[model samples]
Target: NCIIAASDYYLDDDGKKAADLYQKACEFGHPDGCKWAGWLYMTGFGVDSDYVRAIKFYDVACKADDLEACVNIGFMFENGAGVDQSYSAARDIYHLACERGALQGCNNLGYFYQEGRGVEKDIRKAKSLYEKSCNDEAVWGCNNLGGLYYKGLGVERDIQKMLHYNKMACDRDLTIGCDALGAIYLHGRGVPIDYQRALEYFQKSCSNNSMLGCSFLATMYASGQGVTKNLKKGLKLLTRACEHGSNLGCNLLKVHLANEKAQ
Candidate 1:
């Protein structure tokens, strides 16, 4: 009912109708509907922008034990949306949601500990939380753990472990993981130096929409490192990387384009 109406409004771009249905659904005790209504109000998607209303609906959803709602509330607090900026409050709510088994909440708490945002800087605690989230199959958690291992933060420098974690993250279809793996291969950091493997990983990451990966792939094609030199293919990838808003990519593309024109 509410869901159908919401979908209809979404398809029609009818914000007013969506807001009304969501409001009614929220009053009927539908937590998900309340959550959607909160987002709509927060972003002014259907109704006039009202952070206070968003906060109220989020509070209601959180009281209903919605972990996502709790996490959203934490974000609002962290960003000072509709409430006084308070990292402590954000941390507390993030902790609550993490305890409730929200992997994103765990990741956020880990980030706070990692950067000493709302808590004492504790690399070890951050690593533990990242590992916990990773074990729970969180892709970002695996990426963070891999980064920590790579940088030897609160853990021994273990290139193999870093590669392992990045692979885990990549298996979950995370572009970051694919890009990291490509870098490791390109630089011979963890695994044996293999241009072919680097190209493969880079292509995977690029296909996943990573501009960095696209740029790297362009270089690989330009230099004939793994694949045969194809200036045209390289140019296309470089152009795409630039269009994706990578300044380095733009520079690289401009240089190559000038060189091609000179030739």
Candidate 2:
């Protein structure tokens, strides 16, 4: 398909060629082509960022029953990107998408319920929605459900359940879940501490781009908790984590730098 080829070209950094192909596909009334074109415009990949034009193409794809396009429209409304900020509108769209079996929409709606953003704050409803999303295989939904279980919000406190859900999410390759498992093992929350297990979980999370995991692993390395002490390796990991926006990593790196200077 021209759209698929366009995507390949885009991934290869031939934005202009991709845009031309996408435009051709869009002219053929391919909904996905229109969506891709909109994305390119929205991100300024192959063209200038034009929120207005992006909205137009997205609207077209959404009208064609593209679920992702509807979600994108909801995001645009929620963030006031090329449109008026209207949480109410976003909520309506998400509700529609959820009704159509979009798990991401269910997860987002659960968040709104939890935070009282567009809907009334209802922890019970949030829990139920999260359960539905998790059942639908949304990893973030499982993570959120684990958090609720851990905090005993709208459900009885159940550490076992929390661990179960978090582990399930981690097994599915969610970095946040891996980070949670690492923390649990590191601190002996519900079981005896196992520094080696904690280190492995943190390593998995860090490999998946979790800055918090990198920070924790760096600390362990620095102190030789589970691995051989290597201050140089620790400092490098800490620096990487900080560069990736971990405030804890940044703070720890600063302390380490100051201590090294003093020595």
In model 1, where do residues sit more than 4 Å from their true spots?
4-28, 36-57, 80-84
Compose the digit string of candidate 1's lDDT tens values, residues 1-263.
99678869967998878888888889999998888888889899867999888989999999999888888899899999999989999999999999989888898899899999899999999998898889544678999999999999988999989989988988788888988999888888867888998998889989988899999999999979879999889989999999989897999999998897998
lDDT of each: 0.89, 0.87
Give the number of the best model, judged by lDDT: 1
Candidate 2 is scored at a TM of 0.88
TM-scores for all candidates: the values are 0.81, 0.88
Which lDDT tens digits does candidate 2 get at residues 86-200? Answer: 9999999888988888777787788889889888999988888788888535777898899999888889988889988988888888989999989988999877899998999
- For TM-score, the strongest prediction is 2
Clashes of each: 0, 0
lDDT of 2 at 64: 84
Clashing pairs in 2: none
What overall lDDT, based on C-alpha atoms, would model 1 receive against the true structure?
A: 0.89
Instruction: Point out the worst 10-residue segment of candidate 1 by lDDT.
Output: 131-140
Cα-based lDDT at residue 23, candidate 1: 81
